[model samples]
Target chain A: MFEYPALFAVAAVVREGSFERAAHVLNITPSAVSQRIRLLEERIGAVLIVRGQPCTPTEEGRKICRHVERVAMLEQELRAVMPSLGGEEALESRITLPIATNADSLATWFLDAAMGAAKRQGFLLDLSVEDQDHTATGLRRGEVLAAVTTLEKPIPGCDSTPLGSLRYRATASPEFLERYFADGVNARTLAQAPGIVFGKKDTLQYQWVRRAVGHDVAFPTHWLPSTHGYVEVSLGGMGWGMNPALLVGSLLEKGALVELIPGLCVDVPLFWQARRLSSALLDELSGAVVKAARASLLWTGAGR
Target chain B: MFEYPALFAVAAVVREGSFERAAHVLNITPSAVSQRIRLLEERIGAVLIVRGQPCTPTEEGRKICRHVERVAMLEQELRAVMPSLGGEEALESRITLPIATNADSLATWFLDAAMGAAKRQGFLLDLSVEDQDHTATGLRRGEVLAAVTTLEKPIPGCDSTPLGSLRYRATASPEFLERYFADGVNARTLAQAPGIVFGKKDTLQYQWVRRAVGHDVAFPTHWLPSTHGYVEVSLGGMGWGMNPALLVGSLLEKGALVELIPGLCVDVPLFWQARRLSSALLDELSGAVVKAARASLLWTGAGR
Candidate 1:
């Protein structure tokens, strides 16, 4: 069995991203932190942490850190059931739960869910933002214990729960409409006009254009990665972009933003996937996510 | 001489992240795009584009792409001076200018500057968000032509202009103060209370705590990566965090958020670093950035 103390040292070094910072967190000397890491690596027969300006973990280190996180979650649950197991230190110790989520869900409802879970469980949240289509890769890589992803199917050793769909509208400002699509939004106009893309990874606008124009139309795009920036730039007549319905509903109603094609929307279904662990904290978080999603996201009968 | 047509194909493939999409943008067949890449590789005797699900570039590929971007900027300037050189097609061809910036600046003032530049030049912006301390790395790597960074000194072949310092205040909601610092915010209380962090890269809270408490206090932190989310979570009483003065000014005035320690602020001086190229567009962008920064950021004369 691995030494729990040395395992925790490995986890802290990775989390803090430096041996000195890890020592500060662990309340040990820097040399002691180094010795613990060296001992852990020797026992495992592999190098774990790569020393750098900000230390990074090797593949073996990541796996060990993931194991440490799982153990920490289980310990939290145990302390909850038996308060005497840990007294003041238990109350003060906040386990960090690293989870992956997309920008749209985070901008709209993910925080409310996260806040609720953090308050109830008294834990710190470490959120990693990624495209919804790719969030599951973090789970597969053991980088994140839970993720809000578009994958309906769960990764092995993980439980997937439907979190409903986030709807998007291809929105543009009044001035943008007049300038680019004065005649109408056709394939030719779209091919000529500039659009807004989140990044290279984002294909929302491309997919929407294909659906609206009945074919793939390659348009010039301004890549702004921020979810809120998408709305701001669109409103400022920078470019038409796929803005979430939850975000642009009021703007659309106020005539600040108009859909490129009225009534044409894309509903991207999201799922909450968490490692299958017998931890009450994870269950509580999953419940909060489902509750928040139900309150904010659209749930068509066929979504499930 | 290297063919401009094949060079453009290389830039488009790198920008679009795929040969097929590059073909769409270049208005050519995918086979032709493949042939251009193959020919370029043969001439250079080095692999340019790596064929993948979403294509990536080798080191040589990146260097070539940077050259193409500079050439495009020069061409745009040329077209501007002699309007008769190109007609309708020139007006529609919007070049993508990749720039790096910190998230706080983007949320507060960077987009306004970007909008002005984009509107005047009719170019698309591809923004890469990094920490202020690390934004220069992108510029150094040839990944971005310009950056809003904290580096006061210019890179080897770049121009660095002072953009003023963005002031930050360590803030928390009233409830958070009462709950966490009921006794008083000393080193002991600080070590126990949870804080909010942008991510592992953020050290604002740590710096502030060390300055205030007179020692390094390893406090628990909730890592929420979004700039807007930071304010929302702080307002929601999740944790105390360092918030930009521009974003939390009204909140502080309205008593929605309170500083942990009054009269103590961290001023992160920002500089605009762009490649020293003889292009009118780069000069115009530099002017816009400087103007916006002067208008929004705090300029205590010593910032220069």
Candidate 2:
């Protein structure tokens, strides 16, 4: 069997981005850290790291880090099942699992899933928030083991599970509508009004406009790039934009935001895509995420 | 001369990601929008777009869009110089220029540059906040017209100019340093103490540790992924981490943060990398950015 200690050392170095820092985190001398990494690299017959200002892992190193992360999760599950076999290291060890997800989910319900998983598996999660359409790119590059994405399809060696949909409605503060869109929702008028967007890649507002007006229209946009900020900006009368139904529940009731198009809604279906790791901890993490997604998202029988 | 109206329509459709939206923005019919795109495509003898849920520009289409944006900017600059020649459309037209930049610059001083350029050039800015080290990838991919990056090396066919450097220091609340490092800054103790990090790709903490301790060491980190949140977390004594000198002026004066390693500072050099656009407005934008960067960042004479 591969040396678990050295493998964990490699994983730590990759995560921490420095040999000294990784050594410190592992509570080993820098020399010991170097020796462990060298041992692993020698055994694997590959240069694992490109030592620079802040060292970066090689492609081979990334593969090993991903494998070690999975193994650590499996070990955690194994220890959970067979507590009698647990040693001092297993009792207090916390593996780092880097994950990629969209900004909207992270702002909504994904944190609950992550906290639940952390509590249950005793692993620290490193979440990298990107756009929903692109999170799977991280999974493909082995930068992240799992991602919550819009793609219903699976990667080469991954599993994709349906995780409900986030339903959004075009909304604006009443004052914003009265000021900018006084002429009503038409092609000419949409061009004059501003809309808040999450990022350059956000197409929710455009898609809503296409559906609502029966034609695509170009308009000015305020790129907030934050879920919370986007909502606030829209509600603060800076712009009119799509807000998730789950998040706008209270605001809708309080009449803080007026739905511009009552029947027009955009449904963004989400999926939990993960590298097909045999670890029960991954299964547990997926379970927690699915549970949380269901709790907040509109249930539309998976694979949308 | 070469159907500026049709070309602008194509660019708008690409930006808005829909034909209907482009049509609305242009104050034209959807059929007219489609016709303009078809006319442009037919003239160029190429497929300009891949019509999907969110229509994307094809390779040739991207080139045309980029050219049109540049031409629009040039026209705006021209109108500025010769206001008597400006048409009604020229008076109100706003070109969109997408740029990639690091989060630190965005939070610190880049917005002022963007606002200055926008106010002068009549352009809407789409800023994609990424890490400085990787912003060049966006430049290479033609995803952005320009990027503020750490790489002094110019991307092929792009202009790279020195934009000064951000100075960072290892800092934390005085109470935190005392509590965590009562014995001293050692690997064993650092592993147990939490540190706030901006993102997974952020290596400021690791770099600081390497410089201060003179060895690579691993440590626990809390990835906040927000410039503002990371600072607040550090100030609240949640964790110790590197804070930019420009950002922590007030905090340093108030003794909210104590330098963990005195005289240990990391200066990350930055470059403004941009496609060699022939537009006068792009030149103006770069001048504004360089001026702003000089005002904030420590100048290292270029080519570092």
Candidate 3:
């Protein structure tokens, strides 16, 4: 059994970390907040908060709060769609698509296909981004209608369409490359070179080294987990490591960083996959993706 | 965007179909039930019941109710595991195995594997079943820790352990076979035979008939969606069709069902697959499964 305050109220409290501040932020009386939390706990039979100083969640409270967060998120997305739902004529045919993608894509060019599709046909968008590697998790959970995955196989009940390759080059600032690989970048020399990595768990650099050397090689690698920070570290000449071409374009153009091995890039073919729900929304989204892939990476065998 | 009553409340209403009935069931006043429904609607922003002779769901209401049902199911499962969670001398690791199987296997033998593993180590079960063809969907979604699948190919980011072949024989009551195939049981003759099917969406019979003959053949089939009922219909001499050997052992012994095609049974190889999470729980579960498979089926391939 679990309960929490209205999601917005709970979220406000969590964000502010105090009932007084959360009440102020939400423009509600502190007594009201206290009463709501008390009522919620009574109904769910789970104490949600530890009342002294900054509040913390009981185990059950954490679960209930998580539920609230999910509902809040769904509500935010639903709000974006509710406006269009006003007209009952289109209501029957309307279906919303929930998709999960990477943050980089959301900021970059991922929305182009969706935008084009929206221009022609109206649909609601529910997008959640974790990370490229973990996108499949979202697809598996039924949280998303479709996903962009590093995984090649389709989730059951869903079909996969290859988008295009995402190629990354082993690159570094000219200063770093010159300082470390002045002897012209051989396998032994490269193995000893200091490197910047995407994250502790990110094995892109290690994989690149193996592919280049045709064997397993361990190196003293520095972890800069942030996508933006990763390129910044490489650009600052901290070390040599693989970077997405799209992200390091400015550095490449400025001649600040040089590719250690030209055409020795890794191409991870992207895919758009979704469950085989007999949903017209899915079909429309699929059509939009196919069309966009033709204009973007779909033709370069990125979608093989 | 979508909200219904808390799972227990929804269960009560679904059980009784009215505020008064639900109030009586829960030993609460009808006013309390009305208040709960009103609050639930405001929180979920979905109209769960139409103000009519009987309650009905708006689309959003149906979705919320579905979520309530899912939450209810998970709660029941969690309660079952709660007792063991309190007993902790050694640090026991929990791993989730996601498997996709038909409901019949899920309700039957799958639980046996969990029971077998319970003595050796502590485990958490995350059971999800789609149709045999859709079990792989769980793998794609990562909802399951492992799966029993019909697909030959392994999903990405996971490995597959072949459990063995699951053979479906064309079986029916002796009386049924006698009536349907009075002339003889051959491809063409069976095409003209009446058949019992799992459901309208089930195409097993259709596939069997098409494979048997050089051309596509249609059989006059009646729908019996439940697995037990499908077998029952065939056993009652109402029709002839396929039935799993595991469920028909006693009937076969009693000569109630005779196999129409001897040694021509269709065998779909099953697999146990999981995400490549490096955890002790998965390792133990995998060990139990491999041991079970050794004792159970005809597996040749290796997977870890």
TM-scores, one per candidate? 0.97, 0.68, 0.37
Q: Residue-wise lDDT of candidate 2 within B1-304, one digit each (tens)? A: 6788888888878877678767766778889999988988888899988896468888888887877777777777787779797663621366667888887787677766765676555466666778778888778878788999999888998999998889988888898889898888876677667676876568777788777777755565656676655576577676787888888878988999888867689999999988887777677788899899999999867445
lDDT tens digits by residue: candidate 3, A230-261: 56556766568777777677788889889987
Worst lDDT run of 10 residues, candidate 2 chain A, spans A87-96
State the weakest 10-residue window (summed lDDT) of model 1 chain B.
B86-95
Top DockQ hit = 1
Q: For model 1, how does the per-residue alpha-carbon lDDT over B1-304 read when each residue is reduced to its tens digit? A: 6697888888889899788888887778999999998998998999988887568889999989999888887877787779787733422367778999999999999998898889877888989899888899989988898999999888989999898899999999999999999888888898878898897767788788878988888888788889999999999999999999999999999999999888789889899999998877778888899999999998886625
Per-residue lDDT over A108-207 for candidate 1, one digit per residue giving the tens place of the 0 to 100 score? 9999889979987888899989999999999999999899999989899999989889999999999999999998999989987889899787888878
lDDT of 2 by residue, A109-190 (tens): 7866765675555566677888899898889888888999998889888999898889888999899889877888897788
DockQ-better candidate, 2 vs 3 = 2
DockQ for all candidate structures vs. native: 0.67, 0.16, 0.01
Runs of candidate 1 with Cα error greater than 4 angstroms are A43-45, A83-92, B83-92
Residue-pair clashes, model 1: 0
Kindly give the number of clashing pairs for every candidate. 0, 18, 18
Sorted by TM-score (best first), the order is 1, 2, 3
In DockQ, how does model 3 score against the reference complex? 0.01
